[model samples]
Target: MDTQKIPSPTLTLPKSLTGIQGLDEITGGGIPKGRPTLVCGSAGCGKTLFAMEFLVHGAMLYDEPGVFFAFEETEKDLAINVVSLGYDLDKLVAEKKIVLDHIHIERKEIEETGEYDLEGLFIRLNYAIDSIGAKRVVLDTIETLFSGLPNPLILRSELRRLFRWLKEKGVTAIVTGERGEGTLTRQGLEEYVSDCVIVLDHRVTEQSSTRRLRIVKYRGSTHGTNEYPFIIEENGFSVLPITSIGLDHTVLSERISSGIPRLDTMLDNKGYYRGSIVLVSGTAGVGKSSLAACFSDAACARGEQVLYFALEESPQQIMRNMRSIGIDLDQWEKRGLLMFHAKRPTFYGLESYLTAMHKAVNDFKPRVVVIDPLSSFIIGTNQFEAKSMIMRMVDFLKINPITVFMTHLTTGVNDFTGIDISSLIDTWLLLRDIEIGGERNRGMYILKSRGMAHSNQIREFRLTEHGVELLDVYVGPEGVLTGSSRITKEAQEKAGQLLRSQEIENKQLALERKRKAINAQIDFLKAEFDAEEVETLNDIELNKLRENLLLQDRIDMARNRKGDIITNKNSINKARGNIAKS
Candidate 1:
């Protein structure tokens, strides 16, 4: 029976994470799995490091063993060089997590002959992958084979076949190449590994060096179209993600104290919103640093971890200065609630600064982070670039509920803040130096606060031993009260109030005395009138009794007379009647 012709099954494209966060971000997920990606760059662009990190990350982060075929550097040389990055190649090799093969091909030893294929190279790679069960492979700078072999026609044909075979083997691979004149790789190696391509670039402008990584082409994958900066630090590599924008970060409605109770009140809020960015801006010696210290002290008092980034002053110097203001940051440091990271801005590039900051924050894991005077962060960078860096940093920190305070030193009279990151800030506190009577006074007020009520009136603030004291807005004839004028005016007003109070008391005393005298006079007049009334009444009663006696005596006399007359008449009549009776 004839063998049935078998058709191959359809293959789905798989993605393998390179374990580099920024790289993974740029590539969307990672390089296409079981396929080769071309990485081309000129000298010292970290082309080799990129490939090595891919393998190392695969082994460490993904638990996927990798095979590295280095065409330029020997295994011993590679192991020694990567030691600084904290990658131990020897250990990984011993653990059977990786296999390192350094293939040396010299033009002097090889003579190009006819009908030759790269089957030997394929055999070596197959055996290594099978032995270690590597799911990832890196043929570093495979374009070097062009220099070793003279026949271009045969070399090109074999190179195409090699990429195909690697893809067929079902292992993710990184093939590094040197940059060419117009094409991607020096040997025009972009044709074979056309699925995904990355270009590394190193350039110096204005005496500052920056390394940028860009994805030239990702055939079937959506990726970030911007160039991202990467740095190699002590711990490992880090990518300053240029794409930190979105609502993807976690938001919080909760608030935290500004470390200054009065300042918190001025925020017109519960406090600064958790995971919000705060900017304190002022001229020189306007208590910007003092305010930052207060905030740090406040956070420490709450038993919250704080990361203090002192870009200008030494840690001890800052501690000593804050101590004078009654803010004991050293105590917090001792208690392990506060950590101080001090460095000079002039000694490092922007990338290095961000890398250091990122590492410090990750390691420390503080709820509050302070960059004392972010003005120095723009020392060597332009305003736009510095603000961009700050924006990215803010996005990074705001993902958690970590509050950030960055102080900016104002320059001119017009510029309230030296930089214009106000648009990105959640709460902006502006400090002004008011010149009066040949003295500089610090006035503070809130310029803006998102999602909260804030006081607009400027307040005269003083830095005392107890920290920042935001005094009441003294509204006087000239304006708000401040300094000696406020004190003098208050004293004068108090004196006037005392004088008015004394005058009122004297008038009340005089009125009370006059009232008492009048009352005494009224009592005497009433007694005099009562005596007169009693005397008049007695006289009238006596007159009435006398009249009654006289009238009764007269009446008795008249009755007696009348009775005598009647008797006389009766006697005469009686005589006449006696004669008639007889």
Candidate 2:
């Protein structure tokens, strides 16, 4: 079989970067280049701002001149609105890099009786494009242009023509539209554009509003289909793509201190892995925030930047409170090594908070971030949302390789689940109150720490004037002891030990006395034996003298008898023998 080897079309599509943080990443490098993209949303959903940002980003960042045809606002209104974002529109205008045209349509003047043609509109748009040699265009809205014309057939035709003309003009464009009932746009502009369609939504749940963006459709391109949370502030628009960050982030082996040396000792003699998520969870007044402050202090002391997001307390209040623990957070703040963003959790939605954190991190480029009491995010929502937000947050920070130290205040004294985000944490430090001897004491232990051998012993720590001092909890026959009980037990043991030492000393002295008495008895026995030996020698000498005297007397008697018996020697010997025989 003969197979024809046909060349495959380029898998990648030409794209224009939006220059908006996280927006370009989700849209796969912005919307399709040189094509019309529809941005539709309800009122106050930032549809117009989205489109304007596209144009402004195009002009300023890409060096591509742009034309913005506004149907709702004038040039002055648009410029004033965007000026807060630090965009000098008038300067761009004077430079002939941008062209702003406002199309005014009074609905009261037109009737629904005739065909609507956009030839005149086309001429003005073409002139604007030609004037600036624009490569990007933004139509503030599609509804305003067709508001006077009620015929759907004519609206569809003109919408298609508008999109076609923009495509032929070879300028990447964004057309803003009001959301319709169950439709993406009021006039079904998504059908005409066909290239790209983005939907912005401002939804309020539980009295909290969050602005979100989702790519509805993109022809011939893959994009992030999930709804991405976005924010608009003085700095400008930002989109937070949750799934855009994956688990492929680079990991680090470096470790940073938690500021408490004992706590670090509990964690494998190292504090925490760099670019890892650490969660400190505890009950109320269990010193969760204090531990977080210690981490921040340690990081700042190391000359690393820390972004502390305080949800409950103000920066001044936190600094003041931390001062009692001998931690001067204000010094780090003044030195510009630490930055605090204190805001109430209810001030905005979770997504807004996420976006704010994202912006703060991006702007500050912090090496470490501290979110004290992450449980506060669950004020109005459930744990699911908070966990999702935290997951996204962890993913973002992990990718940046920033070490995150978070504090979570548990609801119950024994409850360890703080928004149920334990699985996302790499190191979890659990603190609780240990009640003993009618007194409560603080104890901390590592619940889990990945990639290291951590201590399982619960260390009772006190928040004294010198900071967190971890104490050794006594474990004995009375179970674990802390507070006064531990102190009392230690004192009793010390007294017993002292008494035992005294008793041992007395026994050693008694043994020494016995040893000395035995030595004296041995000395006395040796002296008695020496005296008996001298007496025995004297008795033997006396017996020898007596025997010698008796022998002399017998010799003298024998000599007298022998003198009468014999005269010659031979005869005396013979006579002595005969007398002996007789």
Number of the top candidate by lDDT?
Answer: 2
TM-score of each: 0.76, 0.74
Model 2 pairs in collision: none
Candidate 2 accuracy as TM-score: 0.74
Off by over 4 Å in 1: 1-14, 181-183, 245-255, 268-270, 273-275, 333-338, 362-365, 391-402, 413-420, 436-439, 450-452, 475-481, 485-582
Per-candidate alpha-carbon RMSD to the true structure? 11.8, 9.7
lDDT of 2 by residue, 1-582 (tens): 546765344547889998877888997788899999888999999987888887888888899999999998999999999988889889999999899988887777866656557788899999999988999999988678666556767767877888898999899999899999989877777778888889999987777777788998999888988887777865688787755556788889998888999888988998899999998888889998899889999999999999999999999999999999999999999999999999877786777687788889999999999998788888665566677678888988999999999988887776567566777889998898889879999888889999999999989979988898899999899898998999999999999999999999999999999999999999999999999999999998787667655655555666877764344556546544644543
lDDT of 2: 0.85
Q: List the residue pairs that clash in candidate 1.
A: 474-481
* lDDT for each residue of candidate 1 in 293-398, tens digit (9 for 90 to 100): 8888888888889999998999999889888888888889999999998986556776677777877898999999999878886765466556666776777788
Best-fitting candidate, measured by TM-score?
Answer: 1
lDDT values of the candidates?
Answer: 0.82, 0.85
Q: Give the Cα error of residue 144 in candidate 1, in Å.
A: 1.2
Alpha-carbon shift of residue 297 in model 2 (angstroms)? 4.4
